[model samples]
Target: MESVRLNNGVEMPLVGLGTFKVRGYEAVYLVLDAALRHGYRSFDTASVYQNEADVGRVLKELLPKHGLSRTDVFITSKLAPRDHGAGAEAGCLRSLEALDCQYLDLYLVHWPGKQGCKSEDPGNPGWRQQSWEAMEGLYGSGRFRALGVSNYTEGHLRELLAKCRVKPAVLQVEYHPFLVQSQLLAFCRASGIHLQAYSSLGTGCLVAEPTVAGLAHSYGRTPAQVLLRWALQQGIGVIPKSTHPERIAQNAQLFDFHLAEEDMQALSGLHSDTRYCWDPRHVV
Candidate 1:
């Protein structure tokens, strides 16, 4: 239930349930219901995630069932690259409709690459800038409570910082022990932007690391908890996803324990420049 105050003065939860692959209602409903009942008030989703409606349904139905309301929970959706520029507004509007909310608590530019881009194709190098300009329009309209970017490298962030009239409130990226992204993290911190860590468990790879497992065992916790706690200790927000109810509940039990300074440094040494998600370095 801990929160980080965004630059726009909006509060985002330190931990959230990521609904990236919760495709169908059959699965999404049960998992989300369990999370809400377990006291989770934030959910991360996207336009391409293709299940915003399901997420909205759960929030609309479950929040009140759990004695909560729309304002009690935080919902985030993303802008698809194809929707950059002129389409950006409509893209987020569609998400708002699908999420059954008038406004999003946080809206993010999903990637630095442009529409129809599959790789470093080198086409439309200016698309991100255009999209950011369009998103700035949305941000100014107050339709989105906060705005940010995802998968942006330090270079992309630098470009954005130089051109943007409104500073991004957050920067989300694939961050974990294996890909510590030290420089990028420092940049965001120094710029007063919140860094939201995705794939904090390294897409399940961290759970199997002996060092992480040993730490988990010594602390009487799950490796997943250890990784999440590491992000928190570093003062980064994290969104760890799960399909199982038990795992979802377990991910939320991070407020009680604190990692020692030595253990924190040990985890820091696990960085190997690995990436489980797509790299944005070539977007330019």
Candidate 2:
């Protein structure tokens, strides 16, 4: 697997297994098993995803089964919105316990806004900043190899950057040919913050797009591969998930091909500001 170095110098795989709606321990076990079998070294999950323990259990057992160890795998989990305020450190501890790991490879603020703040208004003073402040301490403690944020818009990132004691190492956001956020991507790149793409396959809706289909046809690859490759080609990390062993194996085959410049331009033109998942821009 190809790797990108985080700002802190930790090596992260370019491709990762994202568990969003993937449910149940058995299902997670199956998918994770398949992923490891196919050379996947990174996995993404969250407390809100409800399968952290399941993923943790499988990792504890399966890595050794596959002749790998915790040091060999890169695991990422996020903080829940509800845990945004005073509960941030406790939340990190919960995730640490749930994942059964001494530390996390990467931990992120799941959203730009806070929840259950004392003011009950994220826009109110001291609410939104609370989350990042708490996370900054945890990051300083060395419990997380790197710290980042998810679903953050340019404004959100800008605010965080202005006050942050430790600069965010990454910004994981939803991106695909049809709904790419190019400006946000450029900001992160220019700032030396690694950008990661979630929902890269458009939550499985981009497969039917004529542009993507044409690209897939020309590349002789699946639509999914086209989307994943597009994100990778732009130097953005991607976490595309699948449960089927064949699909899991297929997703890992991204290292062998390249997308041409004009083809990339065509895909870039498909961006419509169409978001397929949760939008955090209005959270304040």
Best by lDDT: 1
What TM-score would each prediction reach against the true structure? Answer: 0.96, 0.96
- In terms of lDDT, the poorest run of 10 residues in model 2 is 117-126
Model 2 Cα lDDT, one tens digit per residue, 1-284 = 99999998999999999998888888998999999999999999999999899999988989989999899999999999888767788888899999998899999988766665432364523544777787777778888989998988888788888988888998999988877787888899889999999989888899989999988998899999888999999999999988888988988899899999999999999989898998776665
lDDT of each: 0.88, 0.88
- Model 1 clash pairs? none
Worst ten-residue run, lDDT, model 1? Answer: 117-126
Stretches > 4 Å off in candidate 1: 118-125
Clash-forming residue pairs, model 2: none
Q: Write the per-residue lDDT of candidate 1 for residues 51-125, one digit (tens) a residue.
A: 999989877878878888899998888998788766767787888899889888888999887767665765544
Candidate 1 lDDT score at position 102: 82
